[model samples]
Target: MSRWSGMPRTTRWVVRVIRPFLQVFTRRDWSGADRLPTGGYVLAPNHLSHLDPFLISHFMVDHGIAPRFLAKDTLMTLPVGGRLLRGTEQIPVYRNTEGAAESLQAAVRAVEAGQVVTIYPEGTLTRDPDAWPMSGRTGAVRVALATGRPLVPMAQWGAQEILWPYSRRLRLLPRKTVRIRIGDPVDLSDLEGRPLTEDLLHEATDRLMDTLTTMLAEVRGELPTRPRLDVRTLEPPRTTYKRLEP
Candidate 1:
């Protein structure tokens, strides 16, 4: 058995039950799944809702692939939820903390072992409120290039309408529709043998973001208003951990 086989059985059971319920409630539609690489790969998706990871996990399971996500370390502290997270072999990422490299190394090992690693390159959920993807961090590109894994750019919409981020509430009154679109894998063969530099990583990140922007625009049926970074500069650094009582 692979090291990932150690993922908690309880977590698997919970996901098996909960994912179906979520699908039914949201009336989700998934497309372009065939485009996902069967072997080791990185899934880069736009973050808009807390439900984004679960939605992607459901589709990955349906496709006969197991996705080990890179989640913030804080989520692993919730009572029942934390136990399930540990059981799933999900790696913890200490955002903006000194231990980020160690967390990233864990992700690298997972990818090298031919596992699917899902990440929100944007680091945090969109602060735009409209849920369009913002400029991404270089973590995804660094990990992908380091492991020589294929990067799959995924675009999703509708989850925000179900469980809106920042609203801290679920909208169950009106049944929401969720759509997931998996784009073709991005080839990074040209950057082989070279160190993963900030410039190259940023360029690749932009490519991923551009693809996501197109998909999101198609979903919303309109282009999003560009964000004013100057406003972001005025705010304090966001923390990766959510303050949930244990």
Candidate 2:
């Protein structure tokens, strides 16, 4: 059984308690939820805020799937936060460190065990000043390809409006509406059995990004004049332990 199978029922109940409050602050409307597989799969969503995981996972809760996320390893050192993450089966990625492979292996095992893994392919929350999705990395692509699982491309908006990235403060003024749209499963069947190459990886990554861009555009009610391809190379900062101390 997955280690997280033991997650206290109260944890989900607690989330439910806060759900209405979140909705009041940022009304949520999710589409294409049917596309999410109840069994093993990967959820690759555009990262915009720290709330992305909780927001997406909330929509996914009723589907008999609990999201196991790829978080920065330093989060594991936090007093209670680390225990909570482990209890929820979140995989920790040690950025720019040797232990990253181990984290990847843990994610693979989770998928193999029929759990959904949600990843922010951009690695960090969007740095797009405007809150657009940053350039994605190949971690999600590699995981999906290696596991042969469907990649559900999720597009989320308004999260940044709720909790601005890299800010010490939250925005309670705007009271924006958060919308999450899940696109159809990205078919990677074409790459199956083919040798994994740089071209293949890039193509797959681009396809995922394209899907996300299209979805986000729909939510924002705007279209891109030109294809923006600036990939952000900055890594996510280590999750600080001090913040978790009581």
On TM-score, the candidate that comes out on top is 1
Give the total clashing residue pairs for model 1. 1
Task: Compose the digit string of candidate 2's lDDT tens values, residues 19-129.
Answer: 676667766677787777767888999987777777776676644566679999999889988877776668999877899878888888888788788878778766554
lDDT of residue 6 for candidate 2: 46
- Candidate 1: the clashing residue pairs are 8-87
On residues 1-246, what C-alpha lDDT tens digit does candidate 1 reach at each position? 543244457646766688768766877778998787766778899888788887777777777666588987998999977877887788999987888989989989988988888988888677664667888887888888988888888889888786765556667657777788888877677876687777888888887788888888887799977652222243443443232111
The runs of at least 3 residues in candidate 1 whose Cα sits more than 4 Å from the true structure, single-residue gaps closed, are: 1-8, 227-246
Which numbered prediction scores highest in lDDT against the true structure? 1
| Candidate 2 deviant stretches above 4 angstroms | 1-10, 13-17, 225-229, 232-246
- Backbone clash numbers for all candidates listed: 1, 0
Compute the lDDT of residue 138 as modeled in candidate 2. Answer: 76
Per-candidate TM equals 0.87, 0.85
Candidate 2: minimum summed lDDT over ten consecutive residues — where?
237-246
